[model samples]
Structures are given as structure tokens and as C-alpha cells.
Target: MKEHHLKLNVLENSQAFLIEAVSKAIVAENDARNWQFAILNLVQSLELSLKSILAKKHPLFLYENIDNPKHTVSVTKAIERLENPMIGGVKFSEKEKKGMSSAIKLRNDITHHEFDFSVEYAKAQFLRVFGLIVHMFRHHFDIQITDYIDSNFIESLLEIEKSRVVLIEHANTRMQEEGVDSSLVWECSNCLCDSFVADKSKETCYVCGYQTSVEECGKCEDYFYSHDLRSIEHLFETDFCEGQTIVHNSFGYEPISICSDCYVAVQRDIDEQWQQRIEEDEYYHWSVE
Candidate 1:
């Protein structure tokens, strides 16, 4: 039990460091000279947080060779090992894994090459990096890091998001000038960037490199709100969809025609109910025979 507690402490501290790094990165994004350092710190935070997760399972896991004991597991090795369930590692979705790999690539580029880093690129990378961090925290630690983020950091991200939207709109305008259909335009839910070209059978966001999926509403036969859109709410919402009724026809349930507006209202009600239930459960501490 004490060992478990110690591991938890390490994880908590690692997460704290990660949050601090992200906050600093948001600030540095405003200044061209400081932005590179911010990227370095963010990458370092990712590596440390990932290792801490592996360490939580066993301190020996952090070591590359348990017998020789001279080498520690590298960030690349740690991320690769995480895919194997037998090693007590969390399973990452393909997109999440891809995002992590991209961050690693960015770190290498910045460290090894004469890289030309731009504010736009950094903003996109930050979204991907922080998105993965948020996922890992929830799945591995069962903690909400958004609760720990300060208002100023949130405001900074909002500003970046607005810029992203403008960039996307400009790109779309160029595509339209080239005779691309306007109906093929899709907004990226990850960065709130409207740079996705839906003309192809499969579409990906040009700005953030996030993949997009089109879901059809069962009632209207029109495109329904996507899981990516829900990701935005997950990032900003306090409870993270604790009781939200995601309009999916899973588990033999009939699909409903939930407009986006109606879905938002239903999600709000669900969140309220979930909060009340959590409070009641904590107060009662009910035990069943």
C-alpha cells in the first residue's frame, strides 16, 4: 500500500510539472524568441509524464535493463511498450498514438536540425500534445487536469483557437477560388479550425492533421455531430461528459434525431444529474449486502 501511495505521488508531481510547462508554453507562444524554449519544455514534460505512468506500474519498468541497471527506458521505448497490454500499459487509440509520435518527431527536429518553427505550427502542436496529455491523465490517473489549469492559460488557448479559425478560413477561401466546392468544407473540432476538405472519401484537417468522420443522423439522414466535436467539450467541460447522452445507436438502442442544440441541452442535464449523484454517493457511502 505504501509503495502504491509513493507511485501515486510521483504521478501527481509529474502531472503538476506538465501543467506548469503547458502554462509557460502558452505564455511563450506570444514571443518569437521564447517559443522554442517553450516547445522544449513541453516535450520534456510529455516524456517525464509518460515515464511516470510507466514508473507507477513498477520503478523497474523505467530501467531499460533490470539486471545491468545502467540504462533507463527511453521515451520512444516507453511509448512503444505502452501499446502492449501485458506490460500494464494503457492502450492508446491510433490517432492518439500518432499525435504522440508527431510530438517526438517535433522534439527531434528542434533538437537536431535547423528547424523553422512558426507560431501557427506551434499552436497546432500544442493542441495535439496537450490533447494526448489530457487523455493519458484521465485514463491512467483518473484526474482532470483542466481543473488545475488557470484562467489565463485558458484565455491564451482561446486566442490561439481564434487565430486557427482565421487561418482555416483563409485556406478554405483559397481552395474555393481554385473551384473547390464549398459543401466540402468541414471544421476541425480539435482546434476549431475550418480547414478540412470533405471532398475526398476520407478527410483530414490540413491545419491540425486530425482525422474527420461524418456521421449521419438517423432521422434526417443529414450529417450528425461528430465525436471530434465532442472532444472540444471534453477539453472545456468540467465533468467531461459524465452523463452526456452521446447520440449513438449502440447496445441495441434506437437512434434518435437529436439536433445539435437539443443535444447540448441534454448533455447539460446529464452533467447536472451526474454531479448530484456523485455528491450523494460520497455523502451516503452506501454499502449493499
Candidate 2:
């Protein structure tokens, strides 16, 4: 029981670390992409949670009466085997499993590849997993992680995540050995009808026909495939420059992917709009109109 309590404490602390890590990833500077670091931070949290359940050389999960050793049994051996998918671990129910597993898969998509938020997917996953993690933290630790994590820890994770991007280059070279460029690839949901995957052997989307000539292999980092595009939207969406794109690279993150020229153009327009709005707000105190 003492061991269980201690492990639970560790898990709580890890959860705190995760929530903080994700918050930092949100604001970090890097050239890789946006939202992914946050997504990866969440992934690390789930991995920690999944690994915690198997502390006893246990296959996924097994339970025992701490004092009555005879009560040890495989969790799956029970007809009541719990399945929780949000974290891709077994718990006790199909809903729990599906919710968690799907969240993890979404996190994996943006973390390990280039992806933008799907309003439908991102909001649902975030709300569910955040609730589930918080709930479990309370059940196990009698503490709340949101209060536990501090700004200092978040700042640290931001720095660490930035550093990790360096190692990614090496990881990409490794993928080159596999004849794929790890940079231009990602993993997406099976329901993808708008996009197609070229790396069937790895079952990942190359995601390369437009914004780049490089076909990235999601399974590993390696070489890139050459491609061509006629319109920027075919590869680079209009959103890329019009504040629709997010980028992560060695330099840091850009919330929008605009060329310096276009960025300046938009900034000028934005400045004018802000000034206009300010003047309007000052002079036109609105009545019900």
C-alpha cells in the first residue's frame, strides 16, 4: 500500500509536469511547427500514465491484494477487464478506452507530423483528456495538478523542448537511412479522404505534394521524396500567409507562415485596422443598434 501510494504520488507529479509542459510548448519558439510540441508534451504525459500501470512487470495491468498475495490475478483474466483508450491503456470500460486512445492518436498525429487543428478533434480530445487526467489525479493523489505546476517548470520544459528539436535533425538523418525524410512526414487518422499516404509500408502520410518537394516518412527520419506544385495553395495554403499557418523550425515557432514580405504587408494592414478600431471605439460609444 505504501508503494502504491508512492507510485500514485509520482504519477500526480508527472501529470503536473505534463500540464505545465504543454502550456510551455504552446508558447515556445522553434522552427518545427506549432501545436505539436504541446501535443508531444501531452503524449509524454500519457506515456507516463501508461507505464505507471505496469509497475509490477505486469502485462498492461494486474492487481493484487497487497497483504493477501493469493489474490494476485491478471486484470484481463477478470471478465471485467477495463479498457481506457484516451491513454491507450486498459482500465474498465469501452468509452474510457475509446476516448483516451483516440486522444493519444490525435496527439501522436500533430506531435510526430505536420497537422493543424481539426476543430472537431482537438476540442473534444483536449476537454476529455484534461478532465480524465484531472479526475485521476484527484482520485489517486488527493491533489490537483493545475495548482501543483508552477511557471518555472513550464519555462524549463519550453527550453528543453527547444533543445530537443536539435536532436530531431539527427533523427531525420536516421530516417534517411530508411530512405525517408522524417521531417516531411506524419501519422494521420484512417478517415483521411482529403489526403493520401505514400508510405504504405509504414502506413503513414507523406504529406509532400504541395508545401514542399520533400516526401517525409513518418515511420522514421531519412530521405525525402521530390515533388512539384503549381499553386501555393496546392502545397502552401492561403492560410499559410494569411495567418493560417504555424511553423516550428530550428529558429523557433511562427504562429503564421507568411513570407517576410507578406508578413510586413499584413502587419501594415493590421496596424491600420487597430488604429481605426481605437478611434471608432473612442468616438462611437455604441447603443443598441
Model 1, span 1-289: residue lDDT tens:
8668757765666667666766767777556456666667677778777877887777777778868767778888888766668775577777777677767887888899888656656666777787677677777777776666677777777787687777677776767676766676676554445666665464666666667566654434456445523322331223326676454212222334445665576566656766887888977886531
In angstroms, the error of model 2 at 110 is 3.3
Best TM-score goes to which candidate? Answer: 1
Cα deviation at 29, candidate 2, in Å, is: 14
Error of 2 at 96 (Å): 3.0
Residue 8, candidate 1: C-alpha displacement in angstroms? 3.7
lDDT of each: 0.66, 0.46
TM-score of each: 0.57, 0.35
Tell me model 2's lDDT, rounded to 2 decimals.
Answer: 0.46
Which parts of model 1 are misplaced by more than 4 Å?
Answer: 169-289
Cα error of candidate 2 at position 90, Å:
7.6
